[model samples]
Target chain A: MTYCVGVSLDAGLVLTSDSRTNAGIDNVSTYSKMYQCETTPDRFLVILSAGNLATTQAVIQQVKRDVHEGKPRNINNMAYLADVADYLGEILVNLIRKHNEQGGFIADATLVLGGQIKGREPNLYMIYPQGNYITSSSETPYLQIGESKYGKPVLDRFITRDASLEDAAICSLISMDSTMKSNASVGPPIEVLIYKRDQFTTPKHYKFDAEDPYLLAIRQEWAHHLNQAFRSMPRLEESQAQPNSYLRAL
Target chain B: MTYCVGVSLDAGLVLTSDSRTNAGIDNVSTYSKMYQCETTPDRFLVILSAGNLATTQAVIQQVKRDVHEGKPRNINNMAYLADVADYLGEILVNLIRKHNEQGGFIADATLVLGGQIKGREPNLYMIYPQGNYITSSSETPYLQIGESKYGKPVLDRFITRDASLEDAAICSLISMDSTMKSNASVGPPIEVLIYKRDQFTTPKHYKFDAEDPYLLAIRQEWAHHLNQAFRSMPRLEESQAQPNSYLRAL
Candidate 1:
């Protein structure tokens, strides 16, 4: 299992993926899940993948092959972020089909793609195992796959288009931290890619490790704050105040 | 679906559960998931359940019947909290078997039980579908079932024996908030029960609707604290500036 999250914000897009992959408790390994596809300053795309490593790698390899063979069948021809998502979905579907034709094993995988194409606004999409995809929008401005629930509450409550890129970056990491605490399936050595809108060609990338001080401090303080917050919740009055007063009023 | 969490703290035990039950979105309804088998003063046992409502109700009814029958299987003869968990588990197994034997539809469910047994310290246990149960301890001080993962991180980081019942209550709600955000299957009209150690009597129970002012405040403030904590993390430069940089050594 893996945890990958991508947030589409007014400033740009924030994408993150953890590197830990494990077939079992004893077989953990590290693999980079962030990939960049660029065809010049006007067109830039980033993909963060989760799920079966074989399926994702195969999909990426096929995409690379298509680009190398460059013609009518290349990702370079995919003019929009949606087009890119569709193209990647096609690659994954074809890879899964071809692999299953050989009768060995097929993998379950998902990919998140977000970036800007020359003339359009930035966009984000999540590509599913069966080659279907959904675009993120203001109503639902984020997408997460694999080990997603633990980190999701904070995102649901706080993330918005008005959010700053700096803040979104921090929010994504906090989400990842919650996931890491509850799930052994997702671990550190995480990749964070931040792309500012219109600055499509370049994005800042950071690799986070387990002992990263800021991560540790956030974990500690969040824990402390939660305890303190709980301590401060008004205690139930000893008198029998109508327990269902609010519900009855409703 | 349901979300239920139990924590064993030095101040006593905290149990919280959401009341939503659904066969599907169209079939959603509210059903109480928290039940107590307290004979008051002499023995106090609260069962917080998540999963099949029918199964939990059957188990509760069975326990009530045992008490109504008296003598051989009453609370007086249960002996300990462990015995109470076993009794509940046996009832669950029997209920499942009877439901299956009659060819009725039955969904799997899990129960979390904890409280004092008059003469001993407060204890917590989680009962599974098969009627087997596991107890909480120093190493594992909490138990959750039915939409557990999303709410698990906070408890993993903060729950301790010395934690106040109030603190446990808050943390569990925060966990529920996370689960509720990630999974539509769990939702509001939440129930919270607190057991103070050695009190051996009726525990305090609170019901919170979606708009409970205290809940709203914590949710808002928690979101702020999480974002602030994330922003407060030092940048990579400061993280890397240490002369004893462990990451560089790695």
Candidate 2:
């Protein structure tokens, strides 16, 4: 199980991934799921993967090996963010095909690649196990893969295109906190990477442990605030009930 | 699809269920997933169902019919909350078996039963498709079935046995709101039932629609507070960066 979230905001793009992988509860291991491909100073890419570790590692290896051997493939040439997404999908499919030819080791591994080249705006994409992918647009503005449900509500309630990079980062962390609480398979030492728009040279990254003071404080405060919020909300009582047919059905 | 959450607080029990059923995106309908069985002053049992509408309805019908006929069953003699849960599970299994024996039907509905008997404190149990169930305790004071993830974070962050009834009710609503945002299958027209401790005769029931002014305000206020909270948190700067071995590997 993994929890990885990438948000594309007006200021920049924010990416966060957890490092806990478990074949079973007893077989837990720490494995970093975020990979960066920065062959040039101007072009940058971040890949957050979830599902079968072997399949994702194999796919990453294949792409790196291709880039290593200087193979003049379609993805090797200069392309925009969308082209990079397509190339990543094609590479995943080809890798899966190669693995299948040799008795596939992993049947399920999906990847999410998001970043920008020097010329265009930042973008985010979620790739399926079938090697198909979809990019986030203005309306969506965010993409999350792996154990997404626990964290989705916060994103839906808070995230917007005009949101600041700092706010996006906080939302991703809050989202990760949600996943970590409900799910045992996902644990801490989370990796958060941020890239300012048009600045492809360096990306901001942070690794948060479970005991981080601020993180712990935020979780506790959020819980307290939530209870307070609920109590403050007006409670509908039986006395206020009007003689309505719908109220009778309740 | 449905989203139902039941919490056991020191004050009493809180249960909320959405009223949306969909075979697919096109074939969506409105159906109540909550069932109440009370011998009045003796026992108060509420069952929330999720999964295939037909299967859930059949299970509920079988249980209700058995009670109506005054059968000499497990629940007939023992009018307790735990006995009620057992009776409900048995009816579910019998209905599933009968349906399966007649023809192949997917009987994969889950039930969350919570209430207080005359002799015991409030108890919450999650009934599985196999008719087996797990009870909620101090450590796990809440039980949720069907589309449970989106709403899980709020519960994990806020729910506690010491929480007041008002707080529990608010938590349940917030959890439902989260589920509805992430999953279109579980939508509004929410049903909330609050059972105060030792007050089995009087249960507070409220139905909230998507356009409910208070609910809308809660959602809006929550979103606003979240953004404000995130902005107040400090951002990590490049100078504060320590050694990140994970990034070194990349």
Candidate 3:
């Protein structure tokens, strides 16, 4: 299982992914799942992937090969970010079909394609295993895949298109930390990238290992605040605490 | 889908559940999933259920009928909480088999049983549809059923066998709140019951509707504290934010 999130904010885009991969509990390993595509100076793109590792690696290799061979329809040649998502979705769909047709194993993967393309607005899209895709809307400025639920409450509470780039980056980590706490299938080293819209340059990337002090600090702080907040919840109204009420209900 | 949790602490036990049930989105309805059994004053028992609504309701009805008819193996006749868990598990497995043998649907419902049987310690057990049961330990003092992941991180952070009854109740509500925020399948009016050790009395019961002022206040307070906590995270070191780093990473 995997957990990845892509946030599209007015300031830029924040993308994050967990690195733990397991075939079985005994066969766990670490692999970087974040890849920044080398697009022309006018466009910027990064992909965060989750699902079958073989399928994802194949998709990434095919992407590199297309660019190396200068395939006419490569991501580097796409004029819009949505076009890039479409191209990636095609690669994913074909790979899945090819593997399924072989009948020995299942092949499926989901990817988040997010970035800015020239004069267009920065955006985010989650390409599904079926080759369809969905972009973040004004109502919900983020997208997630894989083991997503544990990390979602925080994102639902804080993420928005109006959020600043730094705030989005921080919120993504909190989301990741919450996930790592709840699910062993998802773990560190956590990789994060912050892409500033329109610049089309290299985004800031930070890799935090399991023992990273910054990650620990933020986790402890959040726990402290949560406990304090829990303590402050309006006390269960005294009237609601009546004893022996069970007898009456029965 | 449903979301229900039970917490056992040195101070007592806390059980909370959401009331929303649905066969489909268009058919959504509210139905209480919490049941407090009629037992002798020396004992107290509560069950929180999730999964196939029909199966759960049937199990509830069976327990009710057994007690009303003075069946030899009814809950009121059990001497140990573990024995009660075993009894409940048998009923669940037999009910499921009886339904599935007819061959039209999957008969499944998982339950969290928590309370005290006089002279025994307070306890919590999650009875599986397959007739197996698991109990909370000192290390992790809570059990959850249904849409559980979104609500687990909070319990993992705050619950312990030594926690106070009030703290456990507050923490359970927070878990319910988080689950409701991330998944539409789970909703309110939320129901919570707090059982103090040895009292064998009616534990307090509170139900909060969608617009309950207390629920609204806690949700708002939690959001405000979370945002503040996000802001206070250690800043991303400027040295890590180098430009054109993408070119080298490729």
Candidate 4:
């Protein structure tokens, strides 16, 4: 299992991914799910991937190989980031179809493609297994794939495109922390890459191992504050009734 | 789509459910998912249900009919709450199979059954559609059904066996609020039932409609605190590097 989230803030874009992949409880492995795709000064692109490891790896390899071989439609020369997303989706769906046809196995994967092209604003797109993709909306400026539910409430409450890059990065870690606490299949060495809206050089990337200081501090801080917050949450105004007995259903 | 959670604290049990049911986005309806089995001063059982509404209603109707007709294995006669959970699971699986054999549609549902019998300690069990059930453990003393993931993080953070009944009820509401925020399908009126330990009479039930004042109060309070908590969370100490330049992946 995997948990990857990409948030597009007005200041920048932040993408986060967990490293744990498991076929079953006993068959767990760690692999980086974040890839920098053909970055240069004017244009920068990064991909956060989830789902079948083989399919995602294959898609990444194809992208790199396409760039190396100077394919006509490689990420290097795409006019817009969405076109790169569409290219990635096509490669992914074709590979999935090949695997399904050959072995009757499902080889599905999803990707988050985001970055800036020289003239366009920084944007994010979530590619589906069906060779289609969607960008984040202004209201919900974050896109999540794989193990999303555990962390969605955090993003729903905190993520806004107008927020700062630092705030988005911190919130993504908190979201990852919440997901890791509730699910064993998604574990650490978390990776976060932040891209400033227009400075299209190598994006800021931070990798947090299981015992990273910032990770541990925020985890403890979040948990402690959550407990305190729960205490401060509103209490019910019990109606006048007999004490020490269960009040009848009303 | 539904969200129902049952928390078994040392103080007793608290069960909560939303009243929204939908076949699709266009065919949504309101229906209560909480049901009370035949209860006496000595025994109490409440069920929070999820899944196919028809199947759940059938299971509830069968339980009522069996108790009404004086069945040997009815809730009123069961010595242990686990026995009642098992009985409910049996009726559910049988009805599902009958429906499948007749029309070939999947009639699956899940239930959280919690309360106490005179001779047994207070217990909670989650009955699956396959006719098997599992109870809460000492470490994780809550079971949830239908659209459970959005609400699990709060339960994971705050629910413990030693929690006060008031704490448990408030935490459950926060969990529900999180779910409703993320999912339009899981809406109000929210129903909550609190069962104090060793008190087997009708449990204290509170219903919060969309505009309920206390509900509005906690929702606003929680959102405000969450924003405050995020600001207080740790910030990264970025290394000395070129200003406005993306940091390289490390």
Model 1, span B169-222: residue lDDT tens: 777877887788778988888878777887765577787789987667767776
What are the lDDT figures for the candidates, one per model? 0.77, 0.78, 0.87, 0.87
Colliding residue pairs in candidate 4: none
Residue range B138-202, candidate 3, lDDT tens digits: 99899999999999988989888888888788788888989999899999988889888888876
After best superposition, candidate 4 residue A186: deviation in angstroms?
A: 1.1
Give every prediction's interface RMSD.
7.3, 4.0, 3.1, 5.1
Clashes of each: 1, 0, 0, 0
Worst 10 residues of 1 chain B by lDDT: B241-250
lDDT of 3 by residue, A114-198 (tens): 8888879998999999999999998899999999999999999989889888888888899999999989999998888988887
Instruction: Give each prediction's root-mean-square deviation over alpha carbons.
Output: 4.7, 3.0, 2.0, 2.8
Model 4 stretches with alpha carbons more than 4 Å out: A240-250, B240-250
Model 2 CAPRI quality = acceptable
A196-220 in candidate 1: lDDT tens per residue? Answer: 8888655777777888776686667
lDDT of 4 by residue, B165-224 (tens): 888888999999999999999999898888888888757888888998888998999999
Q: What are the chain A TM-scores for all the models, listed individually?
A: 0.91, 0.90, 0.95, 0.94
Task: Candidate 2: list runs displaced more than 4 Å.
Answer: A94-106, A217-231, A235-250, B38-41, B100-103, B242-250
DockQ of each: 0.30, 0.39, 0.56, 0.48
TM-score of each: 0.88, 0.91, 0.95, 0.95
* Candidate 1: CAPRI quality band: acceptable
